[model samples]
Target: MAEALREQQLCLSRFIRDPHSNPAPPGIEARRLAVYRQLFLGNMQSLLAGSFPVLSATLAQTQWQSLTTEFYACHRCKTPLFTEVAGEWVSYLETRSDLPGWVAELAHYEWIETVLLLSDNADPAHDPEGDLLDGVPLLSSLAMPLAYAWPVSHIGPDQLPLEAPVEPTLLLARRGADQKIHFARLAPLAHALLVSLQQQLLTGREHLDALAQRAGVERGALERQGIALLHGLKAQGVVLGTVRG
Candidate 1:
């Protein structure tokens, strides 16, 4: 009895996740079940794909179907509620080895925007708190900084090319101080710097020095450049808050 119940649960969830699958069995009449199953899958797919249009575009119909199938199968999403599905879809891609690395990053890049826009975090607006010279911190309230070895930002089916550009670009995606989500192009030096900050590697002069050593650039040069980049981040609303005095 328990096993039958489990099967029913799996079948129902599958039907909900993607209605375009194998037909329902003996007792579940195809007529009414078909309406619900197809409707459920269509809506779920549309919601998730809309959020990650580029990823959706890059994948073939089969690939997208398979990817989402795997997502529903392996990932135990706490919420059976449909809204949480997209977030879990992105999470599964991140942890799954079969997913293309670039695809994973692209999925995440897409997911973060929706997640942030819908977030309830009460991180009130505050002026970026320090002098650029003090090696102050910079970040956006809705702007969660991400660093990727794969150039996921500039990726599309063919248009926004994904090959890691020889020159790395820092990506700052944020719901603006004006309540708009904005995307910024970042320079390599600046990308590296923000990455450092995101990873807790650089913040003050010490953070700058560490990155400078990695790049083999003069310490003084990076310090000057760091401050300049700091100013630029604030201008773009990338500066979220100070690292704390």
Candidate 2:
């Protein structure tokens, strides 16, 4: 009896996971098996649709359904939580060769908004009045720097570009004290400086010096520009403030 039950379970599982290829378990009505298959796949489709509305809108219905079905059959999600399923779908896209070059990047960009909102990192302890140039700058725990080959922020049904631009798009997404996630377009130098701050490998002054050297500019000029940029970021809650040593 135990062996028969195990066989029946395996048969049902296979049929449900890939109904097109697998036969229903013996004595189970085909109509009942069809309902189970639709229910499981439909629920996953809805979840992914909610998580990636933009991506869904970009792809035709047939293409979208095919992609989701492939994901359901081929990918073994690392996480069991439904909240992380979209992340798993993104990972699956990373391995595919048939997808458009921007598909994976766009999917990831969309997924990041949700990831930041759910982050547990609290506001760091710092001095809001501290000098950005003199003190160690503290990046908000929820701040994320993202670089993309395609203009993912601009991509939609109407704005899809076939070729990537020479300069990549750089963006920063940070959760403000108001609990709102805000996004800003970043210049190259600003992006590099913020990355350095996030690494905590140097003081704001040192980072400015390094950036100045890289840009072949006088240190004083870079310092002035960088300070203003830092102030703007602080106001937006991207930079929490400076950490006192």
- Minimum summed lDDT over a 10-residue window in model 2 is located at 195-204
Local accuracy of candidate 1 as per-residue lDDT tens digits, 26-131: 4777687778766765676688788889999988889997776556545688788665677888777878786667888888888878877776766544445665
| TM-score of each candidate structure, all chains considered together | 0.75, 0.91
Residue 208 Cα positional deviation in candidate 2, in Å, after optimal superposition? 1.8
Evaluated against the true structure, the overall lDDT of model 1 is 0.70
Q: Highest lDDT: give the candidate number.
A: 2
Q: Which ten residues in a row have the lowest lDDT in candidate 1?
A: 123-132
What are the Cα lDDT values of the candidates?
Answer: 0.70, 0.87
Backbone clashes in model 2, listed as residue pairs: none
